[model samples]
Target: MSAPGAGPALVLASSSPRRRELLARIDVAPARVASPDIDETPLPGELPRDYALRLAEQKARAIVRGEGELVLAGDTCVAPGRRILQQASDADMNRRFLELLSGRRHRVYSAVSLIDADGVQRSKCSENIVKFKPLHADEIAAYVASGEGLGKAGGYAIQGRAEALILWMSGSHSAIMGLPLYETRLLLKQAGYPIG
Candidate 1:
């Protein structure tokens, strides 16, 4: 199926609502949303930035051959120093992550990869710093109970109910949500997609 705007069919190799929403912000909706099933385990001694880029590229390449369509994939990671934080799957994990991030600065890395119709691949990375306010146990418990951190890297969503926990943030707000709009638009343009 073709996207609302006419062009070569574009495929988003991801299932992230945040990524889809960011794409909508640029008016470059995907013709298909295909979640590339790839193992996201970090490589031995792999830095967070490299890990994100590698995963993004792997995701795009996993779905792109002979499809005759452009494929876009992205990966986001949150790191506190050299430690990469995994997506919280339960309230206990979320609470622990929040505690770790309290009154501290962490980095969010978002990597995007685009494989054009010609099979030429291009990629970019976005990094943002976020500072969390000191949180009381009750506050953390409430946020965890809200269930907004599940499936989210860093145990928080800058665009969701966890917004109140942020003391300050420096970088692309969209990147924090999982996609960097500026870089995504550039990749779309390079893939010959029309963007307004």
Candidate 2:
């Protein structure tokens, strides 16, 4: 058996730099980052809440977790009502996403999953509501032109310049940025991972 303070090394099942940076805020660095390749297509009629959690779990389990390694994964999505807004793949898509979100309240669901060395899977979800101030054409154009929203869920990075456009927000800002530090800490504690 390992020493009382010893624990399995952490493996992050994602390639997202935001997630890595977020982990750094809590001073918990993963021993390795394993990018999981999985189909992220949502099931027909799936709700946004379920979609985020499912993706997180799947991403976590997709990694070939080696012995003595605990895998952590997370997924974030934007949804207005039941419609899940996918990550913008291009400038046009990004502009459209921003246009849709303008002056509207939307939900950002961030879900986290952890698989411990003992193979116990634990998960949590953080749902945040955010409303953006009405965006002008030039503002949206400039934002889209900046290319920060491309490839990001909700077509905006809460931690970036997009923050200036936010009129109201409730819930964990860390979650909206990508990972929920509070929930992540809880999962780490539950897994007996040392956290300072």
Candidate 3:
């Protein structure tokens, strides 16, 4: 799918600027960014890791792959036990998410899927543990009012002010932010997408 040392053109199956920014940090750029439309509703009793992987693969497959083009997709979610915390759709839901996450450890699962030019799909998932400091009612209220939590998984953005609330974290910060760079780089390199 490539001539000499060159790699196949990459099609990022996501519109997330964050993901694109993360890729830029590694000096990898997608030839195109495709927005994938998929129903993100989790199936009943589906585990968090499985749910994330499924969404990533589904998103990659949803995009039409051109000749010699590779499609990459990602999914990230916060899971408290078996529950998947979705992006909060409203202010109240955001507040509730913060309340539930307060003073506790939760799992952030980031999954990535890459489809090579040969149509082989490779995927990986990263699980990170994060603990937030005990949040006061006023704190939650202030955060909710700031409106940064809305539309973010677990009702918070790790790269934003929410990082201040985190007391500790384990695993990849990039994973919590939405893409696992280490795992992603390995997949891309394995699929012959040139990277150092």
lDDT of each: 0.88, 0.93, 0.94
TM-score of each: 0.95, 0.96, 0.96
Q: Which ranges of candidate 1 are over 4 A from the true structure?
A: 1-5, 64-67
Candidate 2 yields a Cα-based lDDT of 0.93
Which residue pairs collide in model 1, if any?
none
How does model 3 fare in lDDT?
Answer: 0.94
Worst 10 residues of 2 by lDDT: 1-10
Q: Pick the candidate with the highest lDDT.
A: 3
For candidate 1, the TM-score is 0.95
lDDT for model 1 = 0.88
Candidate 2: tens digits of C-alpha lDDT, residues 1-196? 1233367789999999999999988888888899999999999999999999999999999999888789999999999889998799999999999999999999999999999989999999999999999999999999999999998998999999999999999999999998999999999988988886
**Candidate 3 backbone collisions, by pair:** none
